[model samples]
Target: MTITLHHLRYSRSTRIIWLLEELDIGYSIVEHHRDETTNRSQDDLFAIHPLGKAPAVDVDGRVMMESGAIIEYLIETHGAGKLGVAPGEAERSAYLEWMQFTEGTLAMPVLLTMLGPRFGGLDKLPLLQGFVGGEVTKLLDYVDAHLEGREFLLESGFTGADINMEYLLELINLTGMLDQRPNAKSYLERLMARDAYKRAIEIGGPLVKLPG
Candidate 1:
């Protein structure tokens, strides 16, 4: 099957590029850059998906959105003895939990921490920054605790869950809260050391390091 990824520069879509490389599949990447000042996805993305989001892929003829969903789809379609744990495996539940947790649980705080400072009046409020910063730090601690003594989330080697998680942790790290969590820091370092991840960077561009 043919796969074409509609990628946004310096966004979560880069995680998909990493996965595609790990899957060892042949797929084309179509890059969409954010406006330099506005830092918004180009209007062209709306033509691909109604929500106009990145990490949208054209799989054969169907258009798919959401980074988590796309990762699962690729794993189901292309991952066998690689990148994912098949159904009925004991690790499957943990794998699913982490995949969902990355976007569902972790992403919310990161979003708030980022957007809270950028919105007009809120930027002037120290209270807003303290509340959001505290929340992000707590969540980072929870994740770092989960990562202790493990190379991957599910304990079945590096699966798609790592791909889902590393992006969020990297974003959290940029806040400087990451250095406090040693396990979390090393976990990210390990993922980046992968050649697939490096190659994905070459194709999709680097992930965004600073919070907006």
Candidate 2:
């Protein structure tokens, strides 16, 4: 099947790119920018996704949006019997758990904390920022504690869960929100060691500027 990923570099879309590379699936990418003026896409990504979100995928001819949904679809269709755990396997349960945790819980709080500063002034934003940041940190602490003495989030080896979590963890680090957690730091390092992630970085290099 021919897959087309509509993505923006360095955004949550990177998770999709990493997943594709990990699965070794052949796909094409359509790169676009989030408009500086509106802080959204200049193009009609919303025509494909009502929210104009990145990381939307066109599988064959059908379009799918939302990163978590996109990842689940890819894994279920192209990744089953291969990169992911078999159906009804215990690892499959664990995989779904981590994937939902990463996107639904972990990423939501972190993203809210990030937006607090933009929507409210720094001085006034501390309440929401602290609330969201505290929740995200708590979740990260749980994950960090769980990951201790283990190599991956689920199963005996890497899976889509790790790919999902790694990007969120990196976002936390980039925001200077995770420095106090040593296990998270270590886990982030291990994630960076993956060749697929390195390739994603190379592909994304010129599309978005990394913060120093």
Report lDDT (CA) for all predictions. 0.86, 0.77
Report the C-alpha displacement of residue 8, candidate 2, in angstroms.
Answer: 1.6
Number of backbone clashes in candidate 2: 0
In candidate 2, what residue range of length 10 has the lowest lDDT sum? Answer: 203-212
Residue 88, model 1: lDDT of: 95
Looking at candidate 1, the ten consecutive residues that score lowest on lDDT are: 114-123
Q: Per-residue lDDT of 77-177 in model 1, one digit per residue for the tens? A: 99877888778988888888888998888898787775665676444777876777787888899988988998777777888889988887777677677
C-alpha TM-score for every candidate:
0.92, 0.88
The deviation in Å at residue 65 for candidate 1 is 0.5
Q: Which candidate is the best by lDDT?
A: 1
